[model samples]
Target: MIELPPTILQIILNFSIGLIVTVSLNIEVGFLNLPQFGRLLAVLSGAIVAAAVPGRILAASMGLPWDANYAYHLYNFGIVAKINNMLSENPGLSIGILVFTLVIVALIGGLIGYLSAYPALRLKEAYLGITLLAFGELLMNVAWNYDPLVGGTMGVWVVDPFRFVGAGGARFTFAALFIFFIAIAIYIYAELLARSPFGRTLKAVRDAEVAASVYGKDIVKIRTQTLIVGGSIAAIAGALWAFFTGSMKAATYTRLTWTFWPWAFMMLGGIGNNLGVLFGVFLYTVSRTAIILYKGTLSAVIPIDPEWLEYIMIGLVLVAVVLFRPQGIIPERPTLTLPEHKIEMISKKFNREEK
Candidate 1:
């Protein structure tokens, strides 16, 4: 039922957000071999902060009612509308809010990640994963119950930084383009990190913790660092999603949507491979969007309800990937630390010395 342009834009936006989150997951799970089942925690942190923080800052500065209860649904809509109105008039202020929200979200997400390191130090594998999952659920429950924190179960509205683009279709297009730009930036960062020395160290720790430790790598420190980076990045996705949707609900960031879906994307894209993950995200986003848009037609042929069709499709894809192509569509290739020419020169030198 949706029009083609809107559907295409929606797909791009979804793909961008998915890539950001999945790549963040890949950082911890793929590179460090950490079982990060609670990936939603960092994302929730970002969304809650985006929902709660920058809006309040803007509201207070503008002499709006930004009390502790500002996030309550009743007050939230009115205040955010005012904020958007103001932002629409001032492009610089709008951009400032976006930057400010990202910074705060990243810091909060990183803090949570650092705290998670405590458990990471003591627990291994499933235990660590369970602890992280519990952490995410705990935050969700708190946000849902704590009225001041994003209006509790009612959720809260977010400030539209892109309101400066005006109230038109162009706004959606600009937002989608900005989000895609961010996705590309994130992809570049992940690629560079994967090829960096720290990335190699992460691989070493992942492959053989004892060996890496013997080589003077601090296992605990490395994990803490990875979590900090991953958490910050994941939170950015959350904040961006809030901005794009123009609302935030604790209930929206579910384990199924944020955690498991990202895991599936990472697995399908080839875990530990940024480019592979990008491709995987694109494929998944397109397919998922198509199913959602055409669920009415699919419903007549399929026994399942249209509402649950996407879920079933995702589940089936996960299973098929696990059974047939465990390494994903694009399996992870060997990461080389040095340039080919440099390595060739070194090899020649070694050959001459041996002769």
Candidate 2:
């Protein structure tokens, strides 16, 4: 097996998380027509809740000191005396705690979804974005003030699941597996939601709310439902991210870091198509990772920092897509109309949506 550089490995993980976030965003904004500026709020809430719960669960499971037990292990690795002391003292808090911790992360996603309905009141696109952005900032601010939540700026250390299992490189391996499962599940569910009756309703509302409402659709309830579903998926991504990183920090979930890039991915690929969103995620991830990896090469040739260049390229792409291909590279597909049972001459525009 060819071993990837550690930086490459980190990039892969980051890219996966970005893709997941983008897909979730597309489901909400592109399909359901929800105006979400604070998408990171759900992600952060899920991740933090997962981190918080799993640490405690692991502690409770193995009869250990919870978060402190992992610390003890870290110290124990540094010195034989500490190892023997911890073994002699705690004696049995092992890998099971890590598994328990991951479960907490999954549950955290559900919890965020459950709470998302409360914030469903803000429905306007720009307003929602501002609210979400504010929420992300608020989380960081809270972390700064409450040091114990994520160890303040220094950040908290989490038990590496693979490390607990005595595997040298399993951390990335497992993280990849975990992320793959999440992506697959999210893709499947989003697709289902896109194709279902409810999904159609969501699209109708997105395309023209007034028309949908006139045709016996409850806009508020549908929007709320979409928020709950999409937020839940995002929360799941957040939880998986927290576990994969084995550390959660306010900085990780900030607006610039988390929210903006993912949404850009969705826009770049195609707004309403699930596959398009996934493609967007892939494009963003590959391009972003490639630039960062070969930053020196670019800077030597071009007079801009790789980071700035990355943003510039992304912005330019967004502009090109908007002006030339506003529908997106693939474009939002027209909803299909099911055929009637009888052989009636059905040439009445056949529009799936009412508007």
Candidate 3:
């Protein structure tokens, strides 16, 4: 048995990954009303960049063949070892590279977001969702066949900048900062956005595009901005995951892991509710982790494969939640965007109606 403590820590690390994914998705679908089914595309951008960009940078710095070819892939692994040795010898460079990687990842992610908006500009919400999903699938196909992006199926060892902390401390330290600090910071930003006048405009557009336009809200701009911000955040989250795992495999960033699960989380945790998002993520993450962790123990008792059992249980929970609790665990509370006087007027009218 792999000791409960390490397993639990691993689960928490993965939970933070899911938490960031779900929250970013919530910004797209729940808050902004963009049905971003192709969110995986934005995320994969981070992974691809993580593999292709940073590796090239390190390779060039160390006076190696950093070109796009089989020769490069064959020798890059050795070069990476040297880079690690250098990082170990110079702690300052190690930390600096990690920070630099994250910064570059954010910029690349933002660029992906900017590009992802083109499809949304002309398509209706439903069509836009389908188009986005198709685009993601298309990108995956290309990446898999193209050796340069990430060695096709062979994948690549992503930069693990946290090596300075040693193996055990690295993951724990990253997980703590991301889950508690980064995730919470993003949540607060989302909440603040939701309560602002701008957030009210997003709701207006979401509720009725025609009405929003009539009232002077730029529907197109709002939607595009949402996609840009949401997609960028999603990419950073995905890239951070790649760095954490210390590898970049295209298949690992599949629709099921980064896309579908987040949709389920957003729905299960009341849409437009950040607190609800966190709770929903916790519930599903724990359940799924428990199933995977105890699979062997479970197989000894039950004949069915634990993998199959896990999927079945997840599907059942999703269906049950959708059918019985559509509004999610914490039902969305309506945003109070009106001015005090306007709110008072509405209250007075309701009181008058009762009398």
lDDT of each: 0.90, 0.67, 0.76
Clashing residue pairs in candidate 2, if any? 37-128, 37-129, 38-132
lDDT of 2 by residue, 1-355 (tens): 2345676666667667776787778878898766677777778877776555545454455455545433333432233223323323332443354445445544555455545555666446676667657766786688655655555655555444444333346547655655776687778878877778888888888878899999999977786677667676777777778767667666767776667777777777899888888788777777777888888898999998888897788889988987988767777877564546332435344543444
The segments of candidate 1 whose C-alpha lies over 4 angstroms from its true place after superposition are: 1-4, 349-355
Better by lDDT, candidate 2 or 1? 1
Tell me which of candidates 1 and 3 scores higher on lDDT.
1
- Superposing every Cα of model 1 onto the true structure, what RMSD results? 2.4
Better of 2 and 3 by TM-score: 3
TM-score of each candidate structure, all chains considered together: 0.95, 0.80, 0.88
Candidate 2 residues lying further than 4 Å off, grouped into runs, are 1-12, 66-116, 164-166, 337-355
Predictions: Cα RMSD each:
2.4, 6.0, 4.6
lDDT of 1 by residue, 75-188 (tens): 789899988999999999888889888998999989988999999999998999899999999999999889887898888998899888777677888888888999899889
lDDT for model 2, please: 0.67
For candidate 2, what is the TM-score? 0.80
Residue pairs whose backbone atoms clash in candidate 3: none
Per-prediction backbone clash count: 0, 3, 0
lDDT of 1: 0.90
